[model samples]
Target: MDWYPNSDEQLLLRTSARFATGMAPAVSGARWFRDLERGDVQGELTGWPPGPTYQLRSAGDKAARRTGRALLVGIPLVANLIANLGGASGTPLGDVPGRGKPDEPENEVHDFPVMWAAPGSLARTVPWQLDPGRRPEDCVTDLVLTDRRLLFLATRKGSLAKADILGEFARDAVAEVRRMKFSEVNADVRVTFTDGSWVRLSVGNPDNAERLGQVLGGAVRMLAESELSEGQFDRVARFRADLPKTAHPPTYSRLRSGVTLVESRIPVKAGSGLFETHSILMDDSGQPAEPAPGDL
Candidate 1:
């Protein structure tokens, strides 16, 4: 088996990734997409004949499902909000994907597609394994970026599951990655491919979503423990010591303004793919600090 992030490959970011759906904003949720000319969006790919919520045969069923789950998942969503308070994730309940755009009446629909492509565009070739509806819940997927490539990796849920590369593209195949501020948790990102085809996806959390885009675009620097200054190393040690023993090994990155961002993921509820974050900002002397100009 080809081990991902081979020995020489440097990992930039690895985060939970999935299609940007419209359902969270409204009951008539649909998968979002657009054509190459950027002429119009195909955000509701799940719709029959592929149109809008009004076109759905059972938009009310979608509404009912939303209302039913509202009470059940509401608390978790709120906790999700508080946990990500300072981070990028979490938009209010009613905010739809294209709330502010009025000119493109199509854009006002309840959905927002992350794709930009032409008919038969390269984006149509994205692997189906990345779609949740097409896969088993027992299976999990992640979008991973390394110094050399951008790819998806899949595995069974839980720690023992062996991960296999689902698909990949040369790093050059990607033209740009935009961190979109709209949507739930602000976790959405638009990745435009070199062929002019693009996709919008939601990484599990907003902060990680922003970091993924920044690292891929070369806006910041990811660091290895050995690269840390002696003082920074000592500081990280203190930070790591305070985290739970189960926390994943911490990741370090240096922002443009010379501040180091250190973060780690720890188990949240103890099931497959459940983890929360622990982060700290280190200043010049390696003391805890607040966001600096570049850190923002």
Candidate 2:
């Protein structure tokens, strides 16, 4: 199996560093990809989707069952965590039909640590830890889907679930920010940011400045009525308009988008109840790390 990490995986590790604390040094492209190509990454990437071989219906049936458990449980979630974790396995298959040629038998399972965490659950956070050999179930981080990218915690516990605050500010350069429009009714839409900023916009016809608060939610604090100002609006319309493409094969498919697409279960929000969905890009980590928002 190839031990070198592909270009995309390297991007994942670097971008992920903004969120994961105590992450191991970046794995070399060769050795890293080698482990993954050899299926050794399955042990590293807890809850990661199996390879293309298992992606086929005939092979993926069992995988679907394991991921389906989230729907049945109250706090169902999935996350891709990077850490100093380790595992063990037994005997690597020799001459499997589709598996090129056989290599040395890996009859035992071994585990090591890496950097990067992409979980899909609200219960967990960024900068968290995952010991696949121990608690594999709690490695998920909840994500709120934006127009193109997925929003998750930067740190596992109490820090910002979003990535670096400076990163968001830089995102304005790319114009991925979008503001909801409202004319008649009060939008009442809440804006949240990763830096603990939140604000209620369109509570009334007051002014557009109040709406700006919505875009930077989760980062700055909610503004008081007295603090609100129309001049406060940053007219970042250009930034909101230039978001990256989410097409099947993205526009810049050549930058070696390290994110590996997975057909995993995603818990979509449906009013009061949540449902599991078997869809592509369910929790893909191959997204590149632009100077803007979270890579994933």
Question: Which number leads on lDDT?
Answer: 1
* Clash counts for all predictions: 13, 56
lDDT of 1 by residue, 75-117 (tens): 4345444444322221111222221222223432444555667
> Residue 112 in model 1: shift from native, Å?
4.2
| lDDT (Cα, tens digit) per residue for candidate 2, span 127-153 | 222222222242333222222232332
TM-score of each: 0.73, 0.18
Worst 10 residues of 2 by lDDT: 84-93
Give me the displacement of residue 151 in model 1, in angstroms: 1.8
Worst 10 residues of 1 by lDDT: 87-96
* Model 1 TM-score on a 0 to 1 scale: 0.73
Model 1: residues with Cα > 4 Å off, grouped in runs: 1-4, 23-27, 32-76, 79-114, 118-122, 241-246, 270-272
Please list the C-alpha lDDT of all candidates, in the order they appear.
0.63, 0.22
TM-score between candidate 2 and the true structure: 0.18
lDDT score for residue 240 of model 2: 21
